[model samples]
Target: MATQTLHRGRLIDHLQLVVNDLESSRRFYAAVFDVLGVPIGGSGEDYFWADELFVSSAASRAAQGALTGRHHLAFQARDRAMVDAFHRAALAHGGRDNGAPGERAYHPGYYAAFVLDPDGNNIEAVHHGDADRSAASVEISF
Candidate 1:
């Protein structure tokens, strides 16, 4: 994958996961993203974020309600190796194996792995085989 490639995410603008334990969630995400070559954009006492996903404690101001139910979040991976690494990192950092890394019948060349995050959300890292993109990602400036 090119260093400039953007892992195009799905339709959601931003998704917040209110977890029971913020630290565990943070560690879990940190590791997973690290292997996928994404960084934790920023963090607060009750939350940590990356690109379009945010994980927060129930007490955070942005985390307006009780803990959320299980959500299926699929992140784009550059290849099958990255998806495998994602599973290993998640499991090593407090996640549970939901599904092993392998090809799926969802479509041709769809390789993915699934893990249950600290909060039991179904998190996935997938590589939709080789493809091309027009731009890396959408950039915003303040």
Candidate 2:
């Protein structure tokens, strides 16, 4: 028998979201992601910057847009075109557009799109290609 190597799939391993309220945020994400809430552990007042878990300052709360909990988590698209596909699927899945597919000049080769997952948390699908990478290479081989 010959030894063979295994290939690990490429996908999100873990994510972190910063939210205004924990419980409320969990509810929103649950509905959006279509998954039950799973406790992430560590509950108490130490979760926030000022150690005030109950009170979200007016500025912070307002900036959160819709949901009070975690804002956004991004995933890599399988390819450049998949970014658009994800955007369309997201919209069909009740996601609102935050950003459309385009190059982010600030970040080199940053190609991505942003969508709000029913709860106003920004969900993104991105493909980081070279800054100069363009779709112009696509030509009919025939």
Candidate 3:
């Protein structure tokens, strides 16, 4: 098989999830990201954020007084084991099991797990078996 080099980064500027209960959503996402090894980027009075996703309360100005409808966000995982850990952490912290970790027919070696976050959003962690990347991540300087 030919080694394919890919660059993964900066597709979406950001994603915001406005929830009815901010703290519950916070705990749920915090646990989920921790297992995936993405740290909380920062937080404010009504929200907390990771790399590209922001979880906030409906009361926050950015929420515009409405809760976001259900959204599905798939995160990248380093390996199959990380996908398993994400499912467990999500379930332990206010998430419901949507699907267990396993290889999916989405494509060869597409192993993943799904969980419903506090706002009923379908969250997924997927690991596309062994592959090569041009960079672990990319940085765009302002």
CA-lDDT, candidates in order: 0.88, 0.52, 0.88
The runs of at least 3 residues in candidate 2 whose Cα sits more than 4 Å from the true structure, single-residue gaps closed, are: 1-13, 16-68, 130-142
The top-ranked prediction according to TM-score is 1
Residue pairs whose backbone atoms clash in candidate 1: none
How many Å off is the CA of 83 in candidate 2? 0.4
Models ranked on lDDT = 1, 3, 2
- Each prediction's TM-score versus the true structure: 0.90, 0.47, 0.90
lDDT of 2: 0.52
Residue 85's lDDT within candidate 2 is: 72
lDDT of 3 by residue, 19-39 (tens): 888889888888988898888
Residues 4-34 of candidate 1 have per-residue lDDT tens digits of 3233444667788999988888889989999
Q: Rank the candidates by TM-score, best first.
A: 1, 3, 2
Error of 1 at 104 (Å): 0.5
Q: In model 3, where do residues sit more than 4 Å from their true spots? A: 1-10
**Model 3: pairs clashing at backbone N, Cα or C within 3 Å:** none
On the 0 to 100 scale, the lDDT of residue 83 in model 1 is 98
